[model samples]
Structure formats: structure tokens, C-alpha cells
Target: MHLIAIDWGTSSLRGALLDGKGHVLEERSHSRGILTVPAGGFPGLFEELFGDWMRLTGSFCLISGMAGSKQGWVEAPYCPCPSGRVEVANAIVEIEPGRIAIVPGLSDVHDGVPDVMRGEEVQIFGAMSLVGLSDGLFVLPGTHSKWVTVKRGRVTGFRTFMTGEFYALLSQHSILAHTLDAQAPLDEVAFLEGVTQADNGQGLLHNAFGVRTLGLFERMPAGELASYLSGLLIGEELRTQSIHGGDLVLIGSPALTQRYQLALEVSGNTARTLGAEATWAGLHALSAIHIANKARS
Candidate 1:
């Protein structure tokens, strides 16, 4: 049987046509980002872009990122924290006329600290499948980074950091943009130095200004300053979050995974990197699980 899996994130909509074994047969991507979706354009945009894929695949499953939240196609209610595979599997929402299933994101409120996640939940499930029933910590680095702790096969707790998005804003639009240029290569030395500073307990707020001053004083090369800034932010997360000796799984794009692995290593945590395709794999796996459950019911 054929299956369709969509990873509709904030900046892009990605779909994959896969076989029963979760191998991708064909893929499609469009610029219909969640932010670009007009007030009433979700259904039409989804139909126009994916309608053909749906026709070709016969029946397909969808798990969206921004689309699953209150701001996307439809709000798939959140699954409370301390969630498991069963909770996620049971929280699927079906959009009519098509056999499309929207996976609900996870949310938690602990000690009056409310945390939320949308798309990374699927990626975590996908990564978990590869690691088996082992207890470990999963780190998905993105615009809004997520650090998740899983025990056995269930997600016990997780934390989110606005590292990527903050970097983009500060480097491109904020006051720091004046001191830094955009098209710059990474400086390994400066990047490692920033990591060391973060590891030593310098909060991100304390260190972000260093990017500007270092450039002004000509202490660091202008072209590689972005990497230094990136390292500083990621390092802060690694130090403050406390991943230490637990098994660490890094997900996201190749560039992000590589940098995060380096940061984790600098912070004394060893991590294994999982490729980008894990998101699609996990989505397909969840779809298969949903099908099996329906059959059993």
C-alpha cells in the first residue's frame, strides 16, 4: 500500500510519498509557508499543492507543524505532557474528505512553567523508533529548539529554547546586525571560545553583547562572527539544560546537527546525530500505527 506523509513546518510544506516500509517514493515541496498562508487560504492552498499527490497515492496521511497549531489549517488539540506513543497515537485528528490525520503537538505545565511543542513531537517519535525502547534525551534544533527526555518509549519531559530564531533576528534585524555581516563563514576557534564561555556560566544575555564588542575591537574576524554567535547561543542551552551523561540524540538539518553535536561535545555530553529524513520516517510510522489501531478497533 502507498502512504503520504507531510511535514508542514513554519517556513515550508514538505510531502513524501512512501511505500509500506517507510521508504520515500516521491517527494514534493512548496513555498506555501504557514506565515504566508492568508486568512482563509489554508484549505485551497493545501488542496492545490497536495491534491495531485493525494490523487496519485489514493489515500495519504498528514502530520503538520504550524498547521497543527491554532494558527494553521486546523488546530489539532495538544496532548498533555508526560506523553507516550499511545497518547500521541490516540490524539490524531482526521481532516475530512481525505484520510489525512493531523498529529497533535505536546504541551506541559509544570511548576507553573508551561511548555509547548508542535512539529518536533513527530520527529521525536521517529527518532525513538530507531533508538528502540531505550531511555535517553532527544535534542531537535530548529527555530525553536526542543530538548526532550524520554524514558523507555515515552516522553517524560522536555524544554524549548528560542536559539535559532533569536539568532536570525539578532544577526539580521536587531541592533547586533550593525556590527555583523550576513555572508560569513564559521570561525572554529571563535566558535569554540564562545562555547567555552557559555560552558563557564556566562548567561546568553551576558554574552550576546560580546559579538558586537569583539567585532568593534577587531578581536574576532567579521566573516566568522556568525558562527561565534551561533555557538554562544547553543552553548548556553547545553550548559543550562544539563544533559551530562545521558544518551543524546540530535535531529534537524545536517548543518544544525553537526553544530549541535559539537556544542554537546564541548559541554561534556556525547550525542549521536540522526538525519533529517527521520521526520518523514517517524510520520510514516505514526501513520502505520494509526492504521493498525483502527483495524484492531
Candidate 2:
């Protein structure tokens, strides 16, 4: 049997054609993500992107991320915390009779903070498998960064930070807009300087002003403001998260994860990175569990 996995998010749709063993046989993606699809057009767009793969016999489609949200093709409900692969598999919703299933997101109410993740759970589990870790902190850096805790092979809890989105909003639309160059090359020294500032007890709002002042004073080049802001926001996000200070696995784009690794290192933590293969591995894992469940029934 083969598994066709789709990571359908707000901005893009990623699909993978994987063999029984979870190796990717073929893959494709498109910019027409869930947000771009017209009302009630998910099925049509899905067929357009992955119809060939679905046409094959014995192929099962597994989707994750916002495609399972209230706005998706069909709402796949969320699974609670302390969940493992089996829980996620059991929660899968069959959207297309016996052919297609959507993996459920995970929710946690640890420490009075209500946190939820859609596509990131798949990435976290895949990253855990890639690193061969039964327990640790997993960081997925993006618009909504997720800091997840895995214990005894189950997802214990996690938190979300809007660092990336904040950076975008502040840089592009806020008062510091003129100080940033969207295409500027990263200035490592300036970035580290911002991180150092973040640790000085100045809150983000107070520290953010430094971007404009420094540029105004010709102290830091306007071209390098992006790097400094990146460090400041990322540094603050790391500072607030309650990581126990051990090995942290970062799963995301190479560039973004590398930025996070640098911030973690500055905070006296060790980190490693895994890329898209982990998402594929995760979707494959859940799909395998679902297949087993089907056989049992």
C-alpha cells in the first residue's frame, strides 16, 4: 500500500507520494493553498494537485494542517494532550469514504495556557523519530513558532509564539518600517547585538524603539535593521518559553531553523535541525497507524 500525504496550510499546499515504507516516490506543491481556494472548491483543487496519485490503486490520502480546520474540506476534530501516534491516527476523519483521511490537530491546557497546533504536530513527531528521541523539546520556527514537549513518546504539551508574524507586522507596518530593508543581507553582528539587548531586561516594546533610534543616529545601518529585529523578536520568544535547557530539535526551513539555532546557542542551549523529510515521516507514521486500525475493524 502507498500513502499520499498532503500538508495543506493557509499559504500553500504540499503533497507527497510515499511508498509503503514511507519513502517519497513523488511530490508536488502549489501556491493555491486553503485560503486561496474558492468556497467549496477544496475537492476540485485537491484533485487538480493530487488526482494522479489518488488514481492509483491501494493509495490512501492523509491530510494535515489547516485543511482540517473549520474552513477546510471537512473538519477533523482535535485530539487532546499526552497523545502519541496512535491517538492521532484514531482521530483521523475519513473525508472521502475509505480513500482520504485528515489527521487531527493537538490541543493542550498546560499551565493555564491553551495551546493548539495543526500541521506542527506531524512535524514534531517526525522530528522526534529523526532524532531518535523519546523525550525532549522540539521547536518549529515560523509565523507561529511552536515549542513542544515530548515525553515518553507522547506529546506532553506545547506553546505558540507569534514572533515571525510580529516581526512582519512591525517591520512592514509599524513605526520602524523605514529602518528595515526587506531584501537586506543578514548582519550577524547586528543580530547578536539585538539578542544581547533583549537579555538586558528591556521589554520588547521598549527595545523595539532602538531600531528607529539607532538608524536615526546612524549607529546601525538601515540595511541591517532586519537582522537586528529578527534577533530581538526571536530572542524574546526564547526567553519567555519555559524550556528545561537540554537538546532542542528545530524543524523547519534551513534558513529559519538556523536563525533559531543561533538564538538557542546564545541562550546556552544546544540544538539541531530537521527539514521537510520529517513532515513526510510524520504523515507516513500516522497513515500507517490508520491503515492498521482499518485492518482491525
Candidate 3:
């Protein structure tokens, strides 16, 4: 069976055509994300890309991410956190005439703090399939990073951090951007040094400006300084969150996976790396789950 899986994110939309075995047959991406797609443009874009497949195979479609947000095609309410794949899949919104289903995101209120996530829930589900049913933590690193805990196939609880967005703003938009250059390869040694500093309990807010100062006063190279700043932010996240001592699954691009792996090591933890293709795995998993649910009904 062929399936259409859409991984719609805030900044981009990625779709894959996959066989019954979950091997990708073809894939496509568009920069026209949730922000770019006008109020009613979903149908047009969906048709433009997959109209041919719809005519030929009439495959079922399952989607995750901002596609279910208020701005997207439909508003699938969030399934509060601490829920499992079965719970999330059960909450899917059906768009009929065609069998397109949107997976609801997750949200919860803990300690008077309300948090939400969209894309990472699918990722967690996909990761669970690969790692098997276990009690552990899954760490997804991106614009909005998530630290998710799973036990017995249910996502028990999770936390979100603003590491990626903070890095972007500090490196490009903040005053620190003026003092640094973006032209050099990452400096592994300097990065580890920042991790060490963070592990030693140096507060992140206090250390953030030190990046610019290091470059200006001590002649720290721009490239190494950039990597150092990145390490500092990520290290602070690890330190504050205490991500060590658990089974850690790091998800992101290879470069990011490596960085997080290094951070985990510095913090006296071990982590297994999941490839960036986990997004595809997630989309396909949602598609298969939805299709099976339909068959049962």
C-alpha cells in the first residue's frame, strides 16, 4: 500500500510518498509553511503537489504539525501531554470526501505553567517504534527543543526550551551579532569548554554576554566564539534540566545530533542518535495508524 505522509512544520512543509514497508518512494518540500500559506491556500498547494497521486492511487493521507493549527486547514485540538500514540491517534480530525487526517498536537499545564507542542509528538511516536516500549527520555533539538519522557508506550511528561530561537536571536539580531563573524567551522574544544562551564553551575544569563567580550578582549576567533556561544546555551539547558542518567535519544540533523551527544558526554550522560529522517518515520507511522483505524471502523 502507498501512503501520503505530511510533516508540516512552522517554517516548511515536507511530504513523502511511502510504500507499505515505510520506504520512501518520493519526497518533496516547500518553503510555503503555515506562515506562508494563506487562509485558504491549503487545498491549492495540496492539489498542486499530490493531485496526480490522488488520481492514480487514491491513497490515505495523515499529517502532523502546524497543519492542524488554527491557521492551517483544520484546528485539531491538542491532546494534553502525558498521552500515548494511541491517545493522540484517537484524537485525529478527519477531513472527508478524501481520507485526510490531522494528528492533534499535545499541550498541558504543569505547576501553573502551560506548555504546548505540535510536531514533536509524532517524532516521539516514531522514536518509540524504533527503540521499543521502554521507560526513558527523548530529546528533540530544534527551534523549540523538547525533552519528552515515555513509559510503557505513553508519553508521561515533557519540557520545552527556547534554545534554538535564543541562539538565532543572540547570534544575528542582538548586539552580540555585531562583534562576531559567521565564517568559520565549529570549534569543538571551545564548545566543550562552555559545556564544562555550564556544568560547573555558571548561570546562563550571566555568561551569555561573555561571548562578545571574549572575542573583543582576548582575541577569541569569531568562529570558535560562535560555537562557544552555542555550546553555552545548550550546555546551560542540559545543566538546568539535568538530562543525564536516563536513556537519552537525541533527534535532529547529524551536526546537531553530534553537538547534543557531546553535551550529554560532558554532563556524564550517554545518548543514542536518531537520524533527521525520523520526521519521515513519524509521518509514515501516523499514516499507517490512521489507515488501520479506518479499516477497523
Candidate 4:
């Protein structure tokens, strides 16, 4: 059977039509994420987006990400952690029974606090399928970066970092905002310097103030200072992880993953990168399992 994979995020939406063999026949993307849709508009909007593809014989669909959230079309409650394709597939919430469904997000508890993710789980599984490894450290960088660990294809646990969000706040609203140019590209030298400063034993709060001082002392240009601040924050995020493997998996956009790969290399590590297509691969994989199971039941 063919597959229609939709990754509906908070700010954007992506869909793909994959042939039975998993080759993409067509794809579509839009900025009309769940947040843009008005109350009770998901059903109609979805039909408008892919009503044609759904009409195609043997085509099935799986929706992932925030599209299944409480605020989304219909809440597909999160599946608990230690989940694999089997567990996730089994929990698939049917939006149109046998035709369309929403893949549930994964949830885990850390130190008595609950942590959750939506679309990132599929990417992790897709990375697993693509790289042919079920166990490794998978990092998905974004506004809320995720550090996930998998053992034999099941996600055991993970952590979330507000690194990107912190960057935006510090670069735009903090006391150091005036001292740096937030729009600057990555300045490798200054960026690494900030990365190094993150490990100086002074801690991030203490080290962050140095950005303004450097500006005051004319130690760095505005653009370079921005890169430095970025490196510092990303470096601080990296400091918490125990990265030692050669087969580290970094999944996300090139711009974000590039920064992570650079940071990892500086710490004597390497990683393989995967793009957004991993989302489709993951959804396709899950769709197969889900369809097969449904047939038996």
C-alpha cells in the first residue's frame, strides 16, 4: 500500500506521498501548522490539503507532531517511553479508521518530572532505520533541543534543553543584547572561543556576562560576539551530556546540525546527519507496521 505521511509541526506542515516501495512520489509543505488553524478547522484543512491523495486507491496516512496535540485536530495521547515501532504502532489513534491516523508522541519521566516530544520520535526511528543502528545518542536541535537515547530500537529516556530559546532571549531581550549583533553568521574562531569559555569552570551565568565585557573592551566585533554567545549557550547545553561514541546521530536542519557537528568535533567526536526526509521514512515505516497489525485484528 502507498503512504501519505504528514508532519504537522507548530509553525509548519509537511506531507509526502510515498509509493508502496517507500519512494516519495510527491511532497507538500506549508506554514499552516496547527497553531494557524482556527478552532475546529483541522478536519476541513486536512481534507483540503490531501483530499486527492486520500482518494487514490491503496493510499493510507499517518499524521505526526503537534497535529495530534490537545490543541490539534484530535488529541492522540502520548505513548509512554521505552517504546519502539511496535509500541508506537499499536498506540496509533485512528482519525479515519484504516485510512488516516495520528501517531502518538512519546513521554518519559526524569527525576520525577515529565518530559515529552512529538515529531522528534519519528525522526529518531527513521534515523535508526536509515543508519541501521538501534542504539546511539540522537540529538535533535531546535528551539527545544532534545538529547535522546535508544536501546535496541526503543527510546529509553531523553532530555530537553531550551538552548535555542535561551539564545533568542539573551540575544534579543537580555542585558547583553546591545553588545552583539544577533543576525551574524557563525564566526568559527569567536564561536569556539565561547565554547571553550563554557568549560572554564566559571559556569554559564558567570561566563555569559563576559560577552558584554568583551564588547565594552572591544575584544570582539558585534557579529563575532553574536557567534560567541551562540557557541557559549550551545556549549553549555553540550556540557551536560556524556558523549563518547563515534556513531553519534545528529538529526535536524543543516544549519542547526552543522553547529552541533562543529561543537562535537571540537570535543573530539563525530556524527552522521539526517534531514527532514527522515520524518517521511519514519512515518512510512510506522504505516507498514500499523497496516499489517490492523489487518490481523
**lDDT of each candidate versus the true structure:** 0.81, 0.88, 0.80, 0.91
For residues 1-297, write the lDDT of model 4, one tens digit per residue.
679999999989999999997888999999998889999898899899999999999989899999899999878998898999899989999988988899999999988999999999999988899999888999999999999999988999999999999999999999989999998888989988888889888899999999999999998899999989989999999988898764689999999998898888888989999998789889988998998998899
Among these predictions, the greatest TM-score belongs to 2
* Model 1 agreement with the true structure over 1-297: per-residue lDDT tens digits: 677788887878888888878888888888777888988897788778777767764567666587888888778998887887678877888876347778899987768988999888888888888766358889999899998988877788888899889899989997788887667766667778888877666678878998899999998777778888888888887777865586888988888888887777774678887875777777887787777788888
Error of 2 at 230 (Å): 0.5
Q: Encode model 2's per-residue lDDT on 176-256: one tens digit a residue.
A: 998878678778888888887888897999999999999999988888898999889998988787767776899999989
Instruction: Evaluate residue 284 in candidate 4 and report its C-alpha lDDT on the 0 to 100 scale.
Output: 85
Worst 10 residues of 4 by lDDT: 239-248
Clashes of each: 0, 0, 0, 0
Among residues 3 or more apart in sequence or in different chains, the pairs in candidate 2 whose N, CA or C atoms overlap within 3 Å are: none
Root-mean-square deviation of each candidate, in angstroms? 1.7, 1.2, 1.7, 1.3
TM-score for each of the candidates: 0.94, 0.97, 0.94, 0.96
Q: Which portions of model 4 show Cα errors greater than 4 Å?
A: none
Better of 2 and 4 by TM-score: 2
lDDT computed for candidate 1:
0.81
Error of 1 at 145 (Å): 0.7
